[model samples]
Target: MRYERVYVIWDLYDGVRTGVADLDGTPHYFASQYDEGPDDYSDNFKLYPVGTEFMRRAARNWNIYRAWERKFHNGETDLKTHPGHGGIDAEYDELRSWLDKQVVLLEALPSLYRAKFRELPNQEGLPGGMLRELEVTWSPSPV
Candidate 1:
């Protein structure tokens, strides 16, 4: 049997918002496992729960920011600012908090588990130097 594990890395802005989600809520840039059946996979297949949570939070924030940006730019809001009428500082703070939480979660992962969180190499001009990739590898337990 072969097992499959998925890893997802997200680009966050200043700590609060998610720039993107890998694919339709799936976070794996690269995923592979040896066993095909669930029986062959480890019991802890979904070990990175926090990472998933982080992505969800980031996605939500990103959507909110995008909406705000649109409204502000389109003159739909009474605020006056380059991105919005006001609350720019507040948004930045929110984004920063989100990013900080993400870091905490990443750092909390066990060293053994870090390999499973692999971050894909950045091809875009975007900065991703602060993010760490976790690589996941699976092997059968020794007899």
Candidate 2:
């Protein structure tokens, strides 16, 4: 099996247990791996916090988005039948822009955030037992 850290985005305000998103803003949490897992999947997965950027339109244009979302979920792809489809695509583009901004914001934080995150459970070369003794000094982003 390939061991890799996935770059998953989440809306921070979403309660701790659910990885849901609120389309009106930037993702609040980013996890490198599935919280608990073995390939959890859903057709709606792409519509959840994982692909929140595309979810932006529900706020600005609810009706158009609802129609498009319904058809897409129902597998109706014809442009004529799905008049709202174009708007989804347009919002997706905007989502990409939002993602770009989030990347910039993440980069501005201390580099140790990434390095430290990777060392999770235990830092490099540390014994597994050390995990129990670990203490972290974390600070929220300030900008």
lDDT of 2 by residue, 19-92 (tens): 22322243333332233355532112221233354334323343444455455555665456443334445654
Q: Model 2: clashing residue pairs?
A: 12-28
Where in model 2 is the C-alpha error above 4 Å?
A: 1-27, 34-69, 78-88, 107-143
Give one digit per residue, the lDDT tens place, for model 1 in 38-76: 534322222223456666665565556555555555566
> For all the candidates, what are their Cα RMSDs to the real structure?
13.1, 16.7
Local lDDT at 17 for model 2: 21
Error (Å) of candidate 1 at residue 95 is: 5.6
